[model samples]
Target: MLVALGQLAAAVVVAVGVAVVSLLAIARVEWPAFPSSSAR
Candidate 1:
C-alpha cells in the first residue's frame, strides 16, 4: 500500500512538472507577439 501511494505521488509530481514545462515552452513561442512592458 505504501509503495502504491509513493508511485501515485511520483506520478502527480511528474504531471505537474510536465505541465509547467509545456506552459513555459508555449509562452516562449508566443513571447515575440506579446507587447513589451516598456512600450507602455
Candidate 2:
C-alpha cells in the first residue's frame, strides 16, 4: 500500500512538471505571433 502511494505521488509530480514545461514551450512557440498580430 505504501509503495503504491509513493508511486502515485511520484507520477503526479512528474505529470505536473511535464505540464509546466509544455506550457512554457507553447508560450514560446506562440510568443512571436502575439506581437505581429497586434501590429496588424
Candidate 3:
C-alpha cells in the first residue's frame, strides 16, 4: 500500500514539473521577435 502511494506521489510531482517546464518553454519562445524576423 505504501509503495503504491509513493508511486502515485512521484508521478504527480513529475507531471506537475513537466507541465510547468512546458509552459515556461512556450512563453520563452512565443515572443514579439518572431514577427520582426518575418519582416526581415
Best by lDDT: 2
Q: Which residue ranges in model 2 land beyond 4 Å of their true spot? A: 31-40
The better candidate by lDDT, 1 or 3, is 3
Q: State candidate 2's TM-score.
A: 0.70
RMSD of each: 3.6, 4.0, 5.5
In terms of lDDT, the poorest run of 10 residues in model 3 is 31-40
lDDT (Cα, tens digit) per residue for candidate 2, span 1-40: 9999999999999999999999888766776657875457
Q: Determine which window of 10 residues in candidate 1 has minimal summed lDDT.
A: 30-39
lDDT of 3: 0.85
Ranking the candidates on lDDT from highest down gives 2, 3, 1
lDDT of 3 at 27: 70
lDDT of each: 0.83, 0.86, 0.85
Candidate 3 lDDT by residue in tens digits, 1-40: 9999999999999999999999888677876756764456
Runs with alpha carbons beyond 4 Å of true place in candidate 3: 31-40
* TM of each candidate vs. truth: 0.72, 0.70, 0.73
lDDT for position 31 in model 2:
69
Per-structure clash totals for the candidates: 0, 0, 0
TM-score sort, best first: 3, 1, 2
Among residues 3 or more apart in sequence or in different chains, the pairs in candidate 1 whose N, CA or C atoms overlap within 3 Å are none
